[model samples]
Target: MPTHYEGSKKERIALDSFIKFMRASESVTSKLAHGLADYNLTMSQFGTLEVLYHLGPMCQKAIGEKLLKSGGNITMVVNNLEDRGLVSRKRRESDRRFVSVALTEEGTALIEEVLPHHVELIVEMFGVLSDDEQQRMGEFCKRIGLAAASEEES
Candidate 1:
């Protein structure tokens, strides 16, 4: 009996490459979370602040949607950021039922300073790959993610 290496070589190579990519992503994200401690920001808090900084003021519900998090989860994140004086929630003028979230001056400054380092960290970790390789990897990952997501719809 012989070992059945039956799949196309290309498929095997792609699967191996994807496994390595996922491992690297997990490792890098863990390191990034640890690194954020210097700025006193947890991963979730940093993510929330980054979203607010980029999107400007938005309703609390909107932030939850963008983050792919539940309203309760967003509320906890917002509460933490608020405790740090990094974000503020204001009632929408048109409808008292809605509340808008905006980063405070402190939050803006914090994210501004941290973002460059975050980018640099990502680059330093993965910049070993050539531009073409990176592009190919991106396309591969995007296709995989889209395929997986589409399966849920079907």
Candidate 2:
């Protein structure tokens, strides 16, 4: 549905585009996240594992930042994965307050297994777009995100 804000044409168009963008993002994310259930992971859990898998060991706070997750939520996700022996945490000798999280052997194995299927789903979704259209869309999305970031800083 388009925006019903009885506003100016510019306002309505921008609002309608934003709504469509958000809905598409959510729908794609949900479809991808649905596959995580086969591995008994929540979206956050899978995101955490995927980050650690790709980026190597990182402090808990960095993981939270990378995933855009709250500290408490990241902590719970880490704790849950740790309980499952999928991840392990080590305190920094120089700063006990900082703890790095890393995937265990099991965690590595699991992400390696999950990543291919996750990627395939993304490829399938983007397959609807022609190669050039996909490239343009990627550029547009990145520009939109950067512009939004700048707007927030202002």
Candidate 3:
């Protein structure tokens, strides 16, 4: 649903656009999260695993940056994965402050199993758009995201 506020034209247009964008984002996230439930993983946990699986071992700070998650949230997610024996963290002898996160054998096996389904779901969701349209949409999203980031920094 669009905004019902009786505001200026620019405000009305921006509000409606924001509403649609959020709804679509929520819809996609919800769909993806539903599948995570089957694996007994939260969205954050799955994201952590996926990033570790793809990006290899890295510090928690790097993982947080990649996931756009907070340090505390990343810590919790890593802790949960650790409890499940899906990942491990090791501190370098030289610099104990630098702990690297990596997928264990079980984690590797699980993500290998899950990634295909995840990709399929993503393809299905975006399949509504043609290749060109999807490309254009990605560009638009990135541009908007950059603009928003700059706005936030100002």
Candidate 4:
């Protein structure tokens, strides 16, 4: 049943476009995930490594919150990273119970290598878009992401 939010043809077109855009985004992400699967990394683990690489050392609990995963999940991710020698966990000097996770040099290099390929794939996915359209789309995405973050905070 089409429950039109607005009684207009433009509204229908806009709604359809939005759904297609969302589906395309999901598809691209899935493809990226598949590309990285051969490297023995999940999306969550990639994200954790990325964060540590860029943001420096962060506590496991804080990283868990960032990933929106449970403490156990973060532990598992950390263990995997550790086994891969991509990241290292150290006990905080002030608190032995607190463990800070930091990307090893290997992890930094890995992300640097993976990032360009991932970005190239995304660009290829959007290659049909003109440069102006791509810039505008990027800006639009940033705005939407900020708005969503703000809403989540509230």
What TM-score does each of the candidates earn? 0.85, 0.91, 0.93, 0.75
Q: How displaced is residue 24 in candidate 3, in Å?
A: 0.3
Stretches of candidate 3 exceeding 4 Å from the true structure:
none
Q: Which candidate, 1 or 3, would have the higher TM-score against the true structure?
A: 3
RMSD of each: 3.9, 1.7, 1.5, 3.4
Task: List per-prediction Cα lDDT, in the order shown.
Answer: 0.86, 0.92, 0.92, 0.85
lDDT (Cα, tens digit) per residue for candidate 4, span 1-154:
2445675788887677677778888998899898778677898898898788778899998888888899999899999999999999899999898888999899989988887877787778888899999899899889878987999988
| Tens digit per residue, CA lDDT, model 3, 1-154 | 5568888989898898889899999999999999888989888999999999888999999999999989999999999999999999999778887899999999999999988988899999999999999999999899999999999988
Candidate 3 lDDT score relative to the true structure: 0.92
Which model is ahead, 2 or 4, in terms of TM-score?
2
Name the lDDT of candidate 1.
Answer: 0.86
Residue 119 lDDT in candidate 1: 80
Best by TM-score: 3
Query: Against the correct fold, how does model 1 do in TM-score?
Result: 0.85
TM-score of 4: 0.75
Q: For candidate 1, lDDT tens digit of each residue in 1-154?
A: 1133456888777677667767888999898997788898888888899989988989778888887899998899999999999999999899988888899999999999999988888898778999899898889889989998999999
Clash count in backbone of candidate 3: 0
